[model samples]
Target: MKNLKKKLGLALAVTLSTVTFATAYSTTAEPTTAATSENVNENTIRNDEPTSDRINQFKDIAMYYYWHGGDIQQAEKDIFKGITLKGKYDVVENAFKEATLLDPYDLDLKLSLASTQIIQKKTPEALQTYKQILNLDPNHFNANLLYGVYSKVNGDNSSYKSSISNLKQIDAKKTNEYLQKLETTETILDENLNTSAPADLPQKDHAIVILGYALAEDGSMREPLIERLKAGLAIAKQYPNSKIIVTGGVPKQGITEADAMSNWLISQGIEKDRIILENKSTDTVENGLFSTAILDKEGIKDVTLVTSASHMRRALTVFKEASDFYNKMNGNNIDRNFTNVVYLDYPSLEEAHKVSKDEILVIYRDLIRTSGIWQYPGLQR
Candidate 1:
């Protein structure tokens, strides 16, 4: 009876072992469908952030080119497509917002967004953005300029007055120094022009023509045309083997002052090859920047700036600063000097009085420039 019981228990154990082995094999088996893995990858591409990230990189490149005059509308469209294509405006808004978070010190991004806000007429949002900018860089020139515009547009007289006052206080020393040098050069130039035998004027290696406040109606350098042309031409003549750049855009109703100046110079025996006309600039800053491009293109090394005695000071500062930025970026150096070509044509006592009055006005206008007129035009106080 004991042997019979032992046989029965062994058979039961074998049956239980077979059942357990079958269950274990089922649990260890993997799903065999390739479609599941592909679905996972597709979900990752749609839900993952790589697409948005690529869009941002492309947007930055677009903005860089846009700032250099390479098509801003296209850049804006590209950025719009990048953010909206993913059905994630939040992602883009967050990306720009977080750039500020990662580096709260990034004033450029802050100001850019703030400017957009102002453009959209979102006054409150723009105010907040300006506040953020001020927190980062209180002395940010363009920020203050826009803030003034903001206040002015919103009827915040107190804020506008304060901003204008602040602009006037920033830095008048550089302007004053340039004005002084211009005065000296003009005095010397005038004495030489009037003298029976021209005084031995200082020589330079190149000439810089500054287009100031656009051309006047008569194809002259605004109200004080002769002085600017005189100073610039004097420098070109002083500099042997050097040329004069007469810069201005097409005049409002007629030919440009550049063309008029060219005609006048040729009549005075100055050869056409010695005169270079930069007739595309509509503003003072462009006068320097585009002229620099021409100089670089021509492989001309030395530079001398010629403008109105009143206008020369500011021109010098802008010209020098821009030239430095350009050279640093291009990784090259050109021999350059921004000597004032003083137009000594203050012929009449009455004319001198008029110039003095104009000088006072010029000083005030120049003081307003620290606020960045180009960026915030409405704030040009």
Candidate 2:
């Protein structure tokens, strides 16, 4: 009876241990199995779901971070991280592509995507995207303008003419003016194609116009502004007789770009009377428009325009176009020639292999504005 009792107790102990071990095993295994199953389900859904649905989902997430989150900087960072940081162009392209799928009516997104495609050298894709934009808004200013410029650059003269015609319907006065300038440009291009002329340096006695950049938040000159100023100063020193015009506005609280430029030039020993302050213009288009008015008042016909290299092409084009319009409006068309403006490129701190698509798009926009297709917002006369 003693031996039977011992054996029965041992068996009970064994049974309890097995049960405990099984319980512990299940506790660990069940959660892991559940987690794996969840992951698999997600993968399956991603694979099986329609692309449009997935695109909408991604766009919804992007919109949440872009607007509802109230953190635009963070949103831009997240959206552009793949491209800006990792140089993963495909990732950003895909994101924009997906986002556009859900919001086909968003003109801005389409423009952005098309610009990115151009930057990537995907010309065919960009053309298709531009076509899509036109389908949505046939007379979209930016779309037609950019498409025209792109077509012109790619040597598609037929498309270029078509785009110009479209623009004419949108703004006839501006289109006529731009068409004249376009013909002039083509003539110059033809001349250049036949014979390369020696590069002519800027004349020292020409009026010097220093284009303004944004000032630092503390009212100090930002590096870009300082660089522009430095270039202006050098030119001013070289051309003591030339009148200097500094163009910019008080975009921040403390001071205007013109003010900073004027102060810097004064400190460098330029006379106050020689410097003209144009502090009301906010953007490049306004810079050209306002500065041209000043030039008209001063009876100045020639100018040496100074700005960053990355911005040089647009700046030169707008200033020339603005001056032409001003001349025509004021009936000062004795020669019908645009202003004799020369460009001086101040290299930007950022290095790029080629001009970016964004820059090109901005050039087109400014060109359209200069053509008088659209007036500056809140502009008086």
TM-score of each: 0.43, 0.56
Choose the strongest candidate by lDDT: 2
Q: Name the lDDT of candidate 2.
A: 0.60
Candidate 1, residues 1-381: lDDT per residue as tens digits? 222212211221222233322222121112221232323432111223343332333223223222222222332333233433221223223334544554567676565455445434556677788777877777776576667656655668698667656655664553343344334434422321221113343344445554544556455555466656555555455554667787776575578767877877777667898888887765566666778778777766556565554455556555654565467668988646545554434564334334343343233233334223433222111
Error of 2 at 331 (Å): 2.3
Model 2 stretches with alpha carbons more than 4 Å out: 1-70, 73-146, 154-158, 161-176, 183-206, 334-361, 374-381
Query: Model 1: residues >4 Å from true position, as ranges?
Result: 1-205, 208-214, 218-223, 344-373, 377-381
Residue-by-residue lDDT tens digits, candidate 2, 1-381: 222212111222222333322222111111111122323423111424444444433433322222212223332343333433223344335456765766777766677667556655666687788888898898986677667877766667698889988998999886676677766433432221101112343453357788898787678888767777777677677667789999998555568889989989999899999999999997898899999899888877667777766666677678877888887799886232222222223232234224555665566556666776442121111
Error of 1 at 273 (Å): 1.0
Give the least accurate 10-residue stretch of model 1, judged by summed lDDT: 4-13
